[model samples]
Target: MTGDVWAVGDAYEVYVGRWSRRVAPLFVGWLGVGAGRRWLDAGCGTGALTSAILAAGPADVVGVDPSRGFLRSALDTARVAGDAAALPLRDGVFDAVVSGLALNFVPDPARAVAEFARVAAPGAVVAAYVWDYAGGMQMMRHFWDVAADPEHDESRRFPICQEGPLREAWAAAGLTEVATRSIEIPTVFASFDDYWTPFLGGQGAAPAYLATLSDDRRRRIREDLRARLPAGEGGEIALTARAWAVRGHKTAG
Candidate 1:
């Protein structure tokens, strides 16, 4: 989250790529969580997932994130946004809670979990998903393959993307009946440009490296990435990607 090349709002749409889209639909289906009375989506980013929850049948689906720029874009996209740790909503205000591909990015995932538990009605469900980076996240593997040097390995910062540790995180948050699943989703790119161009713009991880690349070196990097992919006769790279999802129901008394 440091560095000048980073841009998250609309400037960073691809930051949430086909993978997020591919994963969102699954999070909704596996959640099997009805619309309920109300739903809260924490770390909702630009609110795509929030909108999906609403469409699934919830009378209300509120999206909360800490970034104003992101929220502004989220509102433009027709979803409400607020803080993740201190949601602006009232107490016991939701029937079920959800989050898609968000927890791993949070600095204090535990506090965020406590906040979801606090806002949900007793017996309501709180469910969320994170990319299993160590075990199944593939796009990062692309970057890591190209970027792993003696001084840096960006993937290491993401410990929660692994399943067992993520489950422990839920337990530590006091959520019970915790269950986890490994869901596979496809991440397909149209072309080499479609795959590698997004990175040169310096959006997320790619940008970090892009900023360090000189013009000739950047072009060389692009060529290198292209060579790794299958040639254009309907070339497809199957992202053996996954979403490590976990859910727990609040105790009913």
Candidate 2:
């Protein structure tokens, strides 16, 4: 749990890929991608963003992530296993460069932003989004409210996951017409168990922290979240997942 959870690889693609589905379309919709254009999906975990981009009718798409396993699972796009700050592709060839729910995890978000701009052609769009972990990301908020470990708080480290930081980062990367917005999607769980089971997978920050707890403590945390969640008809627990998205165009020289 102390080390990087992504080191295990593929576990995130399995669990996170499902969790992110609710918000994926919102992220892509904000992008307003055009048909028959090339795209670079940086930090394209399990192809969620890439798949969304494909559905938007891009002529071609390239999916890149640090996890080879994730790239393996990516849909028909050209997949690259590489770091976000140092993409393996050439510069200014893509019509658009986008990332979803991954900018926070990059070693240097500003550098990643710069890379996104670098790989984009003049007049190309550059966009990215990350979960608003401090407020609207209900699933993680529930887990952290129970766990209450400052060191393990995902929101604390993700400085650029909010609108302000996103705008600033985009500007600093020399992108123009920068704008930001929030996207909220519904996450419905069949039962408390449906929500709790994924925590045991040890994929993201919350699950990794949950994995570190003693069995008794884990039980207490589970009960805490279960008691707090607002269950409705058919024992369903509906929660809102929110992400902060930003977009800008590379300057035409």
Candidate 3:
């Protein structure tokens, strides 16, 4: 991958999650930033929520991710490492399991969810947040706006964040009492330069774009983004990011 996956993950460590920040309003809200005593954070990226979980009062957290680079950043905050699909932990050993915007990225998110449920004790709460790609993920829509342009084939190169197939797969994984809802968090950027600089870093789909662009094409993209963003009354547009929250309980054996 032209994108340094680790660098990309690390870049996000400083930047907040547009979608993952909205974990508070969904029905699974109990599993808030600190809902578990001993929590397992599956697909925990850069450790934002994992760090939040620890502060929320968990004794110890095991944050897992597939990226060694992302995990490197995660280590700065918590005990984060490894894969979510096949966690290196024991069964029914966790009081709560939380995943943040990670389900869509994994190859088998369902199996990963099942793994999360398995490690959680019976009656333990399993919670996660996924972006609503088809409906409400605004930042994603902004990304697609550029990627979908005829001047670029960026969509094909970047991964799709479609929500339907993922949710169905989650259901197939035997996560019962599954309930979902949308939560919105406002993203505020200080200026166009602040927003545009991250794109130049080329760490994510946005960065993938910079790698492919001719100088003119790159400038056009940058300009297009700048033109689209309205100046905030308070120097920031209160952009709303949407994510779907899902929760299920492990059945008592």
Candidate 4:
């Protein structure tokens, strides 16, 4: 399997970042954490969630991700270069720990949940969200369907994006009151170009697969998607994206 390329922030912004930003506030609002708390955004690619937390008036927010390139483009939060599975932060230090649209990418998602639980203060909220690639994330779902590679389809590759797996992971992390919900948002593309150009960015899973294809194959795939996608009179392609969000709390001391 070709490793998902996540280095270029600008390319990522064009790929998934734009849609992820739409999900951030919804995920954060679902968390409903109180203001004036310390927050940690694990796997905080480009600080989407971190920015939302900051807007909610957190006393402090720290965003951590392994990609320095993405971190450089992140908002004004304190950014750290680190992996989610083995966070380089002290234990029980944050009032809230969260990740957004990134949990499925971790090699060991269970271990990353453990790390989220570990870094959270007692009774602190620990949460994360991932794209519902199997069904509701239409942008990628349509791409994968047209791409026709079952092996590389994100829905097959990341089972943890579903509600059951996410709830189970949170509970298995020893987190209390684990709950999950779906957040849906509009992803409107100006035209076929708006929808297809991001695939050429070479950032996420679909784009990475696209990069491996011959020009003829790529062109065929593009035309297939252009025909299959539902477009409006003005060539606007409007789709809905859904993300599964899970939240739980550590047992208070």
- C-alpha lDDT values of all predictions: 0.69, 0.83, 0.63, 0.92
Model 2 root-mean-square deviation:
1.7
Off by over 4 Å in 1: 1-8, 75-82, 150-154
Model 3: lowest-lDDT 10 consecutive positions? 152-161
Which ranges in model 4 have alpha carbons more than 4 Å from their true place? none
lDDT of 1 by residue, 190-214 (tens): 7666666667565655467666867
Q: Candidate 4 on 1-253: residue-level lDDT in tens?
A: 9789888989999888988888898888888889998999998888778877877775599999999999999988788999999999999999999999889999999999999999999999999999999989999999999999999999999999999999999999999999999999999999999999989999989999999999999999999999999999999999999999999999997
* CA-RMSD of model 3: 3.7
**Taking the tens digit of each residue's C-alpha lDDT, what string does model 2 give over 147-189?**
8887768888687888999999999999999999888878888
How much RMSD separates candidate 4 from the native structure? 0.8
Point out the higher-scoring one by TM-score: 1 or 2.
Answer: 2
Question: Comparing candidate 1 with candidate 4, which one achieves the higher TM-score?
Answer: 4
Clash totals, every prediction: 2, 0, 1, 0
**Each prediction's TM-score versus the true structure:** 0.85, 0.94, 0.80, 0.98
Whose TM-score is greatest here? 4
Kindly report which residue stretches of model 2 are placed more than 4 angstroms away from their true locations once superposed: 7-14
Candidate 3 at residue 240, lDDT?
A: 60
Which candidate number maximizes lDDT?
4
Residue clash pairs of candidate 3: 202-207
